[model samples]
Target: MKNIRIVITLMLTLSITISNAGTPKNDKIETPNDSLRLAELNDFWAEVSRTVSEGDFEGYKATYHEDAVVVFTTGENKGSVSIAKALRNWEQDFIDTKSGKTRNSVEFRFSQRVGDETTAHETGIFAFQSNNGTGNDNPKQFVHFNALLIKRAEAWLLVMEYQKSKATEEEWNVLE
Candidate 1:
């Protein structure tokens, strides 16, 4: 089962990378709706990313549906942990940095979301750096993100999100 999961993850990473990376002539935004949605999703995601970068856990949590499912493939908190897990993780990470011993940073690249009026799926590349106040600028870890969001009561909320590691930097460079 683990092997299968890894295989599926690899396929998704490859496909998303291919679609977002390089020239991408075949997947251009082809409609007015696409342009509008692209704008909206980008704006909404900007809020989420900002909240994350600032370690605003409550604000970040608000971006997701109450019953959202979030998964981290390369973190210690692995597998189907519900929203509460995120609360815990954020709280702990925040508290861990209380003594001025750490820093958490998030930066996104080449991100885009596409879907219909009530639903959207965003695929992109990002990195979350855990800095221990060292002079080094390298990220301790990073991931490629795939997210699903639903429009509820005219607002968008993430319903499902997945993260994996590697090869997304090139894909991200394709955007900016």
Candidate 2:
């Protein structure tokens, strides 16, 4: 019968289609080496953040490239440029921190890991909370942080950086 033949053909086609539908071809297979590298990068990032918040000037300088640059977006130090100047500022800060005149902590909102082992583009936002530690004053600052790091002889170093404050112009004007 013509109808029976048509039904048989339809069933054969359906079975063939179902049999060919397997796992996706694009499923990612992460290797053990990739996992280890990702973990290493994460640990390095955390150590870098910790050094700054703990007022470790030497540790902070060790984390950066020899010829690096820093830009400030907002604050009394707005439009700040020069890595050496930033280092000097941190050096002074470390001294003050010992006297309890200045203390701060940094909280990163995000740190996206991009690129390969030789180079990486990282970005995030952070809030730097500063206080007198004597309970005299308290203030918080938010900045958009960007950095480009390259592996320099096996260690990753930040070669380029940009930082823009999250505070509005009006807020800076009123506070400063």
Candidate 3:
């Protein structure tokens, strides 16, 4: 009976080890030239904000990736909008504002790469401009944006963007 118990334990241990060994690791760390990418993406982000602030939809659309998706945090259309339409709609909204003021601009600070050269995930904070406008009705604009960027030939294009404008203490959970 002792021998049978020992054999069962060994079988269970072996099965567990084999199953773990067969599972693939999700970590695909890559040493990307982050400075170059940052420069490029920063330029694009600036262009987007500038175009929107200046009420130039065409200029805003020119900075977007061909298939990029922008998620608007506040305003009428608060969901995902196409690259072209997003520019038009956002420009119109800004123009219709009380003073046509853009108190703060958003920036993208590349965090890290967890995939191949063709694809990578990045994270950054959406900073708020504290100085500008007429009053204190600025919505406390601060958020975090995560993006999945894809390299197409010689250009890097944004494929997906997820944003969380606010998080409560109860939801501070990140499962690895």
Per-candidate TM-score against the hidden true structure: 0.70, 0.66, 0.51
Tens-digit lDDT string for candidate 3 (1-176): 99999999999999999998967787543345655665556565677567545556555455557788877564454688666665555564555442455344443443443445456576655544332556554543545667777777665566776674543222222311
Which stretch of 10 consecutive residues in model 1 shows the poorest summed lDDT? 92-101
Query: Per-model C-alpha lDDT, please?
Result: 0.73, 0.69, 0.57
- Candidate 3 lDDT (Cα, whole model)? 0.57
As a whole number from 0 to 100, the lDDT of residue 93 in candidate 3 is 50
Q: What's model 2's overall lDDT?
A: 0.69
Full candidate order by lDDT, most accurate first: 1, 2, 3
The count of residue-pair clashes in candidate 2 stands at 0
Please write out the lDDT profile of model 1 over residues 93-146, one tens digit for every residue.
655444545667766565666698778988877766776668565543447778
**Regions of candidate 1 where Cα sits further than 4 Å from its true position:** 1-29, 75-77, 95-101, 134-140
lDDT per residue as tens, model 2, 136-169: 5466666777777877777777777778657433
